[model samples]
Target: MTSHAATPTDAEAIPNLNTRNVALDRVRTFLTLVVLLHHAVIPYTYFGQTDAKSWIGFDAIILATDSFFMAMFFFLSGLFVWPSLADKEAEKFLRDRLLRLALPFALAALTVIPIAYFAIALRRSPGTTFAVFWWKTITVGPWPSGPVWFAWVLLAFDLTASVLYRVSPNLVDPINRLSLRGCGRPTDFFIFLLVMTAMLYIPMRIYFGPGRWFEFGPFSVQASRVLLYPAYFMIGVGVGAANLHRGLLSMDGRLAKNSWVWAVAALAPYCLLWALIFVKRGMLENPVWLPAWYEASYGFFFSAFSAATLFAILGYFLRFKRSGRSMLDRMQAEAYGMFLVHYPIVLWLQYWLFDFEMPAIAKATVVFVLTVVSSWAVTGILRKIPGAARVL
Candidate 1:
């Protein structure tokens, strides 16, 4: 919550920044944190069971986070790209992106990920076998359990965005010129996204099936996590097209000026989210009332509500600057690396904590915090290590 330093003193010095990227980054952090919460606390539906849980009451809640994170991350990528495309030559941009994103992915896959499996094993009472886990980690490539796969998806998105930038020289001008003029209102934007995405993804699920393709060897399931997750990424593009940021910020800036009112309004969206989850959990105990329509509604509401709530909350925070600018700078500086490394630590922590008889939610919360803090701590410690600081 604490910010360390200001990003920039004046808007003029920074070129072409609209309210959208600001809103999206804040929203991205929140969704990512929520995702950490979901992963840290998977449903009792499967881990040790023989069959998958059909109801997906608990699983459904997490599903929302997965797609939401995807949508928001890609959106942010696109939003940020407007500048990159406009600013950099295509070859230079692609070179930096590949060096920074893809290379790290390969390195993380080879190094950081192996560290994760070993970390989890060492944390074990008997431990993960050195020979078994080492070979598995290396020969098998990245798995779902680690966060490394995200790096791959990120590379994909970056490559896609860079290509879009290239094509933009010819095609984007006719379309993108509108951003110079400005975009439509936020409400109109939200409804547009909701309708468009529902029209887009729902039928795909109905026809193509939800199971993943373009897999990593036997880990076919990970294909969805890598590629299929981009619906949110496209949604990110949609939010940009809608010009939702400035309007939301204009509204949020006003409300944030009145802290009490803004805080209360911020809580409103969450009340419905929690209520829906609570009711769904209890109802699923009995199958008689289940309906196919309800499943669709779940996805619809989850997608819609998450997008709206994220922007609203982000608009609220960024509208008002807290004094702790340095904290924000430090956290933001560290957050990228933190995200890169956190999940594997969380996975290891799961191995340690999985047997505990705690509530699903509570256990997840604990692991999430531990992983986040540990990632921060690790990054900080690594920052001090000889030569490691440069790569980090």
Candidate 2:
């Protein structure tokens, strides 16, 4: 068996993740925080939250910020995976990633499946009551929401990669200038991105159909979300392995160097995206544009805007240099656990605080803040347990 070798720079030593890579750690922490933010803002969108004086206004497409986590998490996960994997032979790499992704996934699913059983039980009425809902939930009932599907899909992807590795490891590898010795150009990479995206999404929409617009909980189209979101992850892999960090770094003091400038210039595109989305949403609801092609196109354009805007935001923020690797370290330690566990915590708090008289926006804001603080706190607490650190 040919053992995998490390990246040439480290000469095969895995950097103690805890000691190094503050930026990456912070990215994980930040993404986790935003994910909670995204989920917490639900319920108000669809369920129409109750407030102090009880004003009920609905949320629009901006609720799609949830996918921003989709984008970030996949990208960051891909960022670390490539270098880490290169150190091992494909067989060992598959085994390692499987254990890392699959164990947590199975444990999380099994653990939460029961809790979801109970939660759905709590929400139901007597006729088709607690036992009925619980049975369905444990079997096929609702309540397995946010972060739930990620584990399942990630495991599936890992398994797929394993099969592909055995058959054609080179075909499975992300196309990269660094690995290919600089053969692929930027235009080629962009086309690769577009092709992967088109392959994943266009077919996904055809097969799975447009996902139900969920304002709360964690249900998504299981059909192909498993494969689709990984496109972004693979794109990130190409970017990182192609060694584009210097180019990203040197893009300083440009128009994009200031976030506000991006904001202003992006205003027109943002408005156009919103307008098109509104038209699409209106048409979709009216039954005129609810077909597969329309749904697929809708997801495509919105994502295009999201990606463009994300680039602008990252381009601006990356120029920033922050002090205090220490804060990042502490947050980073708690991050993975926080990401895995925070949704329920946030939901439970939302339920407990439901009786409190507050505006919907205010309640969402409070939940957002509470979710971050409590998740961070609980992650820290969990890590103090002897065995917890390993899983987290």
Candidate 3:
């Protein structure tokens, strides 16, 4: 849920960010923390009701966060791709991506993911050895990437965009033009994104049925929303390709001026999503496969809410783009590292807390606060190692 800079090597430090997007960086950092909060509260949600106590509020949080966070992550990541590709050679770009993305993904898949999943393994088989579980997981069975799946997927998108850039640097010029037109009318972009994502997503959602995943070895992604993320990513590439300061995300633009309206637009579809959930659970009794009409309705609401919230968040941040000295700026450099390393810390904390006799809200709060601090502290230490800052 965070954007990365250039990769570091043993002799180098973190990439020197001479030109920065403070608003986008803050937004990305906020989303990284939101990712932590999402994981922390999942156990208390209805779908992931692993805790002794559950909360309706956490269900709301899960529903909203799950609907948009990962896609927003892809969008944020894609924002910088066009420029990066322009600035660097294809070989250097690919190498930097491999080091920054694939390296962390590979290391985390082998180390952090096993440790995190061990908590679940223990729950399933209390006496299971970590070594045995790790072996079986890597070789014989399902190996969930945890949240680090975003890294690999983003790298793939970057590579794809890179190739497309070579084919035509102006490939997304039309989208950029639309973004320019959308500055005063953000809903135009929202509708375009909604229609595009719904078209790419709804049929797949109905066909794959939401819970299914496409998995190969340590790689996996939600089957239903696979195309949705790419659509968001490409949109980002288009908007960021040219006139970033004058396009839809301009600080002085109408999108920022009308942030409140975007928030309301976001809320309407969010409420509609809840209503559809209600219908599915209450009226239809939560059938395994809902009718096509219900699935289409759910997809429409999902896409609408997602696009609206994205604009709302971006607009709100753009409105405050010149605000001095935000706290999120401090962690912006380390946000990607925090994201990469936080999963096991959070999962372990949840596992330890699962047996405690406490309310879900209190437990989730403690886990979230502690996870942010621990993850931040751990990333700080890791970045201190030579060349670690580059990749982390």
Candidate 4:
């Protein structure tokens, strides 16, 4: 997430060489790669349901990734914000954030997103020109931002946090205290997060319903989960406020010690979610307006699985913090760039592979592998340009 390395405009909170959490860096890189994988296999999943080849296993993966990845990304992105704000003036922080987040988001929204969707647009208008499609997307209608939506949303959160930090530096201190208390008993933190997320998320989800998007041209977010993301981001800020090393994420802390327990916690909710899915499809018959009770129950499972998996991932990464060199290290610097550019690559690859008669597993595997390699290579080349590393 934080990349652990600072640019001229941005500062690293932890200065000591020994204090850097390489595990988090690795986790961030892994999440970026997972983005590629998620998009690659989506065409073969029931949700996307685009390609002829569909896999039940991919449905499972898509369910899990859809539930957790972006939320975890927000959490990780928030980890460094409090510290970064502490070290810079408000004006400088805004400038740095603009450069780091907004510039790339703008470029991708205007360029990369249109190119990716053109493939989809061409399906309906078989002979549409690239120029015509691009113009129509920007000027006339539906300009989907795709994955770059995350970048803009994160920028908004960072800006909001800066304002909150200015109002009261100790606003998140209570959360910091709780994070400290959870060091030797992470179940407490897990329970707290689950309760908080459910309270914020479930009611909105019920009101808005799933599949609703807050779309306005290139900018859009899931209408229901708008509040949910900020809660996770602020919690991240709280956890990293102070005493990061001795907090719940400490290498020797109970969170890391009982990673297996957290994994089980995650699994229980995952199973519950699938059961609900079965009920929806088989018994409930996929009603337009799901019953309030059913929605609430599904929301509970979704929140539980999401919160548990966050802990599970963090705990596992912390447990293996000192496991020597990792493949994640190689792509660490390019993770952000890869995320920004990867949607187009993955979508185009799926489009190209749409006509193939290959099995779902083989197609997904090929698309995912090639997307990772191609995105990684492109990011590597992009970073070589003078000053590109600062933003990418």
Q: How many clashes (backbone atoms < 3 Å, residues ≥3 apart in a chain or on different chains) does model 4 have? A: 0
Position 101, candidate 3: lDDT: 85
lDDT of 4 by residue, 162-249 (tens): 9999999999998888999999888888889999999988998899997788988877888878899899989988998888889988
Residue 114 accuracy (lDDT) in model 3: 87
How do the residues 1-392 of candidate 2 rate in per-residue lDDT, one tens digit apiece? 00000000011114344434334445555555666666666556642342232223434423435334465456555544455455567777666655555666566655644453343235444255545654665465454544655654555554554455457545534564432432222224334554566567666666655553332233333443445567776655544442434322223324225545444544554555456557665765645325676656655654554454445455444445223544545666666777766766666666666667677788777878888888788878877888767656
- Note the Cα lDDT for every prediction shown: 0.50, 0.51, 0.82, 0.82
Q: How does candidate 4 score on lDDT?
A: 0.82
Q: What is the C-alpha lDDT profile of model 3 across 283-312, one tens digit per residue?
A: 999998888888888888898888888888
Better of 1 and 2 by TM-score: 2
TM-score of candidate 3 on Cα atoms, chains taken together:
0.95
TM, every model: 0.68, 0.74, 0.95, 0.96
lDDT of 1: 0.50
User: Cα lDDT for residue 91, model 4?
Assistant: 96
lDDT of 3 at 362: 94
The most accurate candidate by TM-score is 4
After aligning candidate 4 to the native by TM-score, how far in Å is the CA of 379 from where it should be?
A: 0.5
TM-score of 4: 0.96
